[model samples]
Target: MELLPRRPDRLFPVLLRWMAIGMLSLLAHRLVFLFMYVFQAVRLEPELQDGAVASVLKALFVGLRFDLATLTIWIGPFALLLSLTAALYALPAARLRYRLLNSLFFHAQWIWLLWLHLVSVASTYNFSVNGKHLGWEFAAYFRDLPVLLAGSFVKDPVPTTMLALFIPVWVGAGFFVDRRLSVHAGAADGHPNPGRKALLTALLSPLVVLIAAVVLFRGGLQQNPLRPGDAMSESSPFLNNLKITGTYLIVHDLSDRGDFKTFYPPEENTAFVQRMLNDGRPFVDPQYPLLRRMEARRRMPGRFATIAGPGLPGRPDRQPNFVVLLMESWSAKFLESHGYSAEVAPNFNRLAHQGVLFENFYASGGRSANGLFSILTGIPDRAGRTILRSSRIFNRFGSLPLLLKKKGYQTLFVHGGDLHFDNLDTGLPHLGFDHLAGMKEMEDSGLYSRRWTMGFHDEDMYDMLLRKTDELYAGAPERPFFAMAFTSNNHHPFGLPDPSFAIFPESDPEAAFKNSYHYSDYALGKLIDIIRTKPYFQNTIILIVADHSHHANLDYLQDREIPLLVYAPSFFQPERRTDIAGQLDLLPTLLSLSGGDSPYAAMGRDLTVPAERPFAFFAGGSNTDIIGMMRDGFIYYHYLRSSQSILLKGTHPVDMRDMQAEQPQLAVELDAMTKHYYQFARSLEKENRIWPESISE
Candidate 1:
């Protein structure tokens, strides 16, 4: 008798075979990725050759985790669909027609897998060019696809051609492995009966596999997910980069792509942030002529010695509490402290007299984000971009808050405006701020105002600040707290907490801006008054500084000079410093006063220490293309948009002469230094060396 043909119930095994085949293909791609990375590392960072085999093994091991994450993301949905289809086909009433459907899906999966592997390889070439993996920044090229397509050949013809050639070869290799392992629906070993039990097993298996896939996708259940930063080893950046999977690097940075343009040589940029180097180490990068000169001058005898001794009665036995009041638009133009009239900021003038005042301090850039980045990270703002908000380097910088936290300080960042503004909400946390309170929290406490679009009025912020301070001190009285409070009332529209609070209210808008400045100062005075009454006042250090200056145009200063006051009655003596400083100097100065030797990096110097060549750098305007450098009783401005340099005679700035003709060397030096600073900053960002790699541990 002819036996009944056994039902083809091997769909589950075929699905399993497909999964195993896909994994093998993915593994092959990963090995190629590792090879490309190692090749690049040896070229860029020659030092990586030492223990090359060992480092590669370590990177490969680390890369496996990233690869698993990537594979799960790429294959998950398709796996689920295939598994479900197999289960459905294995039912008691299953049909042979299902084989056609399975074949269609199998082909689709093959095509998708091929595309993903090719794209992964292509991303490495891009990374090789810019030392960056694909991300939202890379996706941005799609908007200008024609330009990217056309320029790919013009800008990098050889690499583009090689990439084009390599893709097909890579995909072919994947296809070969896939074909060897794949088990299609045809000619499967027939089984007797695939009843409900067998069908249920096939269906439920996908869910079980899916759960495992999810665990792999997240790279284990850690508080922080595996990021590109985790790839960094103790080895060089290139070696660290070797461990970075293209997918992980790209996915992490896919959120926001702000205005970011890199305009610096990688080596020069790397050497520019010399803060990680020991003090005795020489920073002699010829590419950075300005830094070289500054380094040489600093090496002079008595140059780094204290310029002004501590004026306090006694130094603190422990680290003092730091209260940084980053006032909004607190321009020196409205303060008598910076030679402006006392009418607009009498309270500020009084505080200046009672504190250490930086007389010629300039803002790093026009925006608050620039000022915040400079003050916190001690890095100058990139010329044309918000470096803090736009770069992956945000997490890398040896931040003030992070260092302070190491020194047992509770780091807190309070802003009257929404912290989400300019991506500050996400950025500040990465910079190591432990607690962030913004407009919503401020409004919940009834400290917010609807009069201004910015957020809370100055007085309201101060009131809320006092309450927060009390709560913090009560929670941890012994632990020194480093609180940075950002005010927003003095921003655009220039509305005060109350009209009566304005000391210099005028009918004119500029005059009203001055009045708002006065109101901000008054609010500061209230906070100070409340602090003095509290027991924490004696050991507290209050640093009141501007996020950036208003366009008062009172002087011909090439940059916008803002008032910087360090009121540490227990540590600093009341003295006005004429040394040119900027927001970059703030963190270094504070660290010096705290007497903390935390291994940190900063672009600015400690003003309390003497330096031979003191200069203030600033770049502002619509595109932030106007770069300016102030030094040696003269100011130079380089307008990138116009490619013109202007040299002014004195502080008043009226006498403008052709920089090339009048002070050719000075103008050239300023222009080169500005470019060098920005380039170095950008390079640091690209290398992911903004913060020391060992910070997390």
Candidate 2:
């Protein structure tokens, strides 16, 4: 066939390309879908949803495989646009005919799209699921997006469907477009060029084949990390399926949570305690059980030196209205602006000047829940698992809200996301919250006009919180106020809510986190403005601290740590103290600052006014592998798996002796106290107690 791009032959190639693309797309979607579904079914027993097996089957089949309904929905608009635009490309005046052009264009489009999906799926699945970034070594697994989808298969299936759709359109569109476009009449005068050049353009066909192969591989790897209620383990049925089918060849260690231990005293197998304080050797005779138990139960002096040595006399003047804004993903030492203002938060700098900003406050855990537990409860997380999540298993925590409620304070717990998503409803109110307001509760309220997420905008939430503050102060003159506010926009997939007031710039981040930071600042500003206008500003002591500081799965905020901003009236001069602290110290700090003896002795010291052992602990659970940190700056990050440690100059490692010493000390004074807290909380949870005079813990 001596062709110069004839129409009949061209159409066949276009159709072929589309078929291959579709097969490849749907195949990959099914692989990831089935993988996640199967993983959850075998590894976890999710209490959130009803039928695990059915949901898994639905996802494995309808959700992942041949989501024709969604495929059409996504492509329908693009198809319309392409068809309209093809009119121009198909016009006779155009030199390029649709016949030879469409296939190539579609192939090129698919390549770009596959890369985008790769990034998306990878970012989600491969993420560390830890607190945030660490230095630069974050969860850069090019595979997080797929992993986090384990249990939350039903949240947004569009991404999976889109991946399926993208593969085919990308593959087929180019070929089809080219073939159709080639029909334009390029007369024999100029277009009389021989057949091979235009027709043999399929020489580039092998490139497409390689791309198709990668797409197939990509699909097979995606799995959900949040396996509904169950944490996934190595023995997942999905992994077996992958092995049987020979679909996916590699399985990555998606999370550091696994290798780490969560229970008290770390894992028995690990040598962390032995290595840290024991000169990298076991304290016991290696195989002695009794000796190991003896070694493990010991305690060391937690506060080596002065956390905060007793010093200044009490401020004779009334305390200021403390507003502690714990910026998400923030660290006290990390913000470059603290060193050189050219690169970091200007608003923080301003706030630091306005109030006393403690420079060395560490987060209690690598998670928001961890920070909240520490700040509100003052008790560090048990050896593993967050106190809030582990409450059903262990003891429920006592919140600052509850502690303050006894002192005549009406408490409010507010956040921009769902209160019950992570059992905040079960936990928060148990801690004595008078009101729990989250995105679900923001319905029809002006506080949340925009809705990318179900939660109200931070600005809107702030507005609502301020109004509530006003109402409480105006009407309820008898009770003091305690409010815990959580900002959400700066969270992962950090897309901006409003660009006009963008505080942080985003040349580009997968998520525009800078914008979220800027927004957080604005929310704080709004809060401050409200405080200025109200009388509560003068009397209300607001404590601002981060829920936890992490950027997505990697917590880079370790340096700056969480900030402790206690804002009150000018009566309390902004006295900057070098008392190092953590979220655990918030309660005792507040209680001490209030000059009232606590109902129950606090694990956290009176950090607000400064006391001995100024630093608080960032007790890492299994997720981060880091263990206790002392206020005197002794941090112990037990790499639970390897047992290898890198002791920064400031912190010391917790050895067998330390554990031996600390455990008994914990047992002696704190154990009974801690147990009482749980007993009290259980009673409160059962009795429908709302800020009762005393819960008894």
Candidate 3:
């Protein structure tokens, strides 16, 4: 270096070669997905007929467009890097360092390609289970990959273990291909001449390539890019799916369809939807179609005449304050009211006896997001989709907070954990909450828990809630208040501040869960005690419900069973209702209890009234598409993918897989119920009328 450093070689030529090779490797990666889909199709089919052959050919053609778009987006950043490398390598100096950089980028491309193929392969299985492409809406909830992987292994260990073994072979093959193609990437070359002709060509070449990449990224000058539905020309949904690659589908979903709304044709299904909306109910006008029926209900003709009146007929004129407590992981599994271990939740038992408890209540899905969305939106959770914290589509929904705000109520959402954990922070405000507070707010108030992840203990949260409620109501005594509080101390890595609160020893997970459950119950008792001492105690109503069951067996009633306790001693009767109910029923019930006369669109009927359909619909286990209908004393399950159904008698510790064979006739009932729920959801999305305030053009 003391002497003049040796001039490096020309850079543009090497960069060009690298870009071409990367494009080829990306094409190869796409073929990997194609082959996997074909492999699954062939295995599922005994022989490939002419129809299948035609389907495959068309799929390949349609798939290319999607693949091209994916490649374009994937290589945009890489292209920029290559352009910089090209200019630097063209310089007489720094050529060696640039060559090394090129090689590293080459290796990085192969690693990324390997990851893409792996995800593509795994998605085939996911599709098989749910009969839907795995999209970004579903992927957004993959926050805890380790836990998800472990749960998958526990569900079916053999398949996961085999996939793990094959991953190395796939990655190694990609590495080998990268090595073969990039052999000349680091080779030294003559320095580029500084002539105007050479400089112009170098600049123009990358510019042209970049322009082409941009066009491809926007998907070939079309008004809109290719979507998942674009590949649905085939008669068979399964064959139609073969035209879509998993990676392309996920990318397309992320780009468009923010809420993951279904594409089912609502106009054609108007009559079907009309039947579902009424179901021979006395309150509904059977002559009207879906939207017309909703309009009719909004009128609430002649004194809100119905079989069941709004909650507490004696106090209908008084608008009571509402507080909904979404207890974490508080499945009926741990509730003594549901005949669990008697020592588990003494306070809940006492509370349930003093109020109305739904004996057949169930959560609509396994996740907390499902319960939260259904409870607040009054809509059934869509199968195989997550809406909470999904920034693209949260504000689209009609929320309870928005409805209550119209009625002069102060709306608040409180959680002991980080509100931003699942995108709740953005979503809650959009839902019409005036105040959204979480762990940060709790800590600021000097209420912090050392044993908890987000600091504030369940006891502290409840205590703070009492104070906050006082302040909110005090601000405007004329305005009623509605608040939702979520507790997290009973969740995984469950713990309690006071060891003496545990009735059972923390020797195992179930024991530890019970201990934490008891402690939460103790905190709830404290909150209730404070409420009882308040001046507005008689005019206040508290609703206790679980987000979802955690440790319950996936059989009939046990899996979806959750407690729904309505505590309003001055108004509602202290009797237990045995009709089937779900999280979706809470909103309409709350509105009725509030004695609000305004009409609203709700998928669930008012639970304060008698249940029109004595069946609760819920999705459980690993597959969300497996819809379950719990009615009478049996649970019927319908697998939407294969149109398979199984009936399991209501009992504890029964295996769902080992249940009785398909009931073809009863399967129709389950199908109708599932379709009805989705039809309503799709109709709302199509009309863009989830809330009464939403204007539909």
Top model number, TM-score:
3
Off by over 4 Å in 1: 1-121, 124-317, 391-393, 446-451, 502-509, 552-559, 621-623, 695-697
The clash number for model 3 is 1
lDDT tens digits, residue span 1-697, model 3: 0001112223344444534544554445335434545666666655444466676677767766766666665555555555556556455575556546655765575566556545644554455554544566246535643454465456546655555445355445545654433434422233444456445544554576677677866558764444444555343445555656566667655643423434346554555554555534333322223222121122122222233344333432257789999998888877776667667788899898888888878888778887888899876665555555322233255567877787678998888887756567656776778897888888777655453754578888887788788888788777788999999888877777877876775566477777888888888988898899987788788999999877544345566788999887876668878788888877766776666454455666676556456666675444666666666566777665555767776556555653454455555665666655565564554344565334331
Worst 10 contiguous positions by lDDT, candidate 3? 1-10
Can you give the lDDT of residue 600 in candidate 3? 52
Where does candidate 2 stray beyond 4 Å? 1-324, 333-337, 342-344, 382-384, 391-396, 502-511, 551-560, 608-613, 621-623, 630-634, 651-697
- lDDT-sorted candidate list, best first: 1, 3, 2
TM for every model, in the order presented, reads: 0.62, 0.49, 0.62
Better of 1 and 3 by TM-score: 3
lDDT of 1: 0.64
The number of clashing residue pairs in each candidate reads 5, 94, 1
Residue 328 accuracy (lDDT) in model 2: 62
Cα lDDT, all candidates: 0.64, 0.46, 0.63
State the displacement of the C-alpha of residue 511, model 3, in Å, after optimal TM-score superposition: 1.0
* Candidate 2, 570-642: lDDT as tens digits: 4345646566676756665565554443343234554433254343445453255544444234443444455
Best-to-worst order by TM-score is 3, 1, 2
Candidate 1: residue 79 Cα off by (Å): 32
Query: In angstroms, how far off is 254's CA in candidate 1?
Result: 14
* Top candidate (lDDT): 1
